[model samples]
Target: MTGHTKAHTMVGKSSQSLPKRILHSGVILYVALAFLALIYIMPFIIQVATSFKTDADATANPVSLIPQVWTTAAYSKLFLNSDFPVWFKNSFIVTIVVTVGRVFFDSLAGYALSRLQFRGRDIIFAMLVAVMSVPMVVLLIPKFLIIKSLGIYDSYAGMILPLLIDASGVFIMKNFFESIPRSVEEQAMIDRAGTFRIFWQIVLPMARPALVTISILSFQGSWNELSHFIVSTQSSSLTTLTKGVASLASGQLSSGNQYPVKLAAAVVMTIPVAVLFFIFQKRIMNSSEGSVKE
Candidate 1:
């Protein structure tokens, strides 16, 4: 009887301590995540703060997150006194066209590769996979050569056409299509729907998550593309935000280092991409959840 009573007392002590242990662990985890988040976000925060600082103050206190004297000179210069609007216009046009083209072409190729069984289909897919493995830097020279040979160099067509079909986007869509039930397409076929009809009306709508993913990726890639723009076009009017900002950083706009203007340009360039991601984040999460369930 005494031993049983002692055992029960120890069990009570363990139960009482369990909540405290859990609370301690939760606190530690929260702190760790908070620190990590801060670390990742600190650079962006500094960029914004520095954008509001005067050029002299920004250079003087480069490491400081808080500005000594806030000013809108950087913004005024970018919007009022520079070629920023033209750069922004070029970026927007290229990004929009590229995103739309990629979504449509990638989906088409993906569906064909995933569902069709033509001769040499395997060979074609293998080639695509191999192409994806090739680094973008390795293709820069070849890309330039091809753009020149095609007589589209130093033009908008040179910039937009080459990036329209991404191998990775095609791969992503193909994989997503394969996960969908074959019966879905088979049933549409039985209803006498044409291949294009089924793909466009039925399968495409069902693949919203994948489409959104590709759209976001294409938009971001084309918006931030610098090397391609550099090789394809030489005109200042054709320059995108990335190239224009790079010039700004290299002292094109001023004699001394204009840190505020450069940082402001950086911050503005980030807003479009950030907004795009946030808008599609829910769709991405939902698609992930659906994939998990499937």
Candidate 2:
């Protein structure tokens, strides 16, 4: 009886200590995470601070967290004198069209591949995998050739058409479809719904996280796309933000080292993605967590 009582007392002591050990571990983890987060965010902090500095101040205080003398000269030139607005508009248009197209077309293709019973589905999937394996840079010349041959060079069609379908988006949608239980789709089919109807009204609506992923990725890609636009269109009026910014970077239209203008352009280019990110922060976080597991 005495030994049993001592053993029970020891068990009680361990149980009481368990929560304290967990709490201590959690505190250490929190501190480590905070340190890592600061390291990751420090660059953006530096970029924002440096963007406000004058050319001399920026150059002198390369790593300073605060600018010595703040100025807006670069931004003024970018907006008022330069063609930044045209480039901004072009970027906006391309991003919107590409995001919408990829979401719709990619989901459609993914759904068909996942759930449909059709001839050549396996062949189509194999081709898609092969196509996805082809490096994007290698296709630059071929895409330009196709755009030129189609007589859409230097136009919006050339800018938008080749980007309408993306392999990554298709892959994301396909994986998301597979995650969902097949019973939901089967029930819809039992109710005599057409495949397109079932996919549109049923499965797609359940794929909010994947849809957000596709939208964000597509928007970022199309907005920041440089090389494709460089080869697709040659006219200044048709120049997207990426191409225009490259010209600015290489001293095409500006005379001096306009660091402020370039930084402001970078900041402006980042806003849309930033807004979308904040708007869908939860979904983005969940999607990120999900992808990490894969």
The top-ranked prediction according to TM-score is 1
lDDT of each: 0.91, 0.83
- Candidate 1: 10-residue stretch with minimal lDDT: 285-294
The digit string of per-residue lDDT tens for model 1 on 1-294 reads 999999999999999999899788798789889999999999999999999998788878987988998789999999999999999999999999999999999999999999998999999999999999998889999999999999999888998999999999999899998887777777789899999999999888888889888999899999999989988999988999999999999999978889899999999999999999988887762444324332
TM-score of each: 0.91, 0.84
* Clash number by candidate, in order: 0, 0
lDDT by residue for model 2 over 100-165, one digit each (tens)? 999899999899888888999899888889998998899998888899999999999999998999
User: What is the lDDT for 283 in model 1?
Assistant: 78
For all the candidates, what are their Cα RMSDs to the real structure? Answer: 3.5, 6.0
Residue 272 accuracy (lDDT) in model 2 = 84
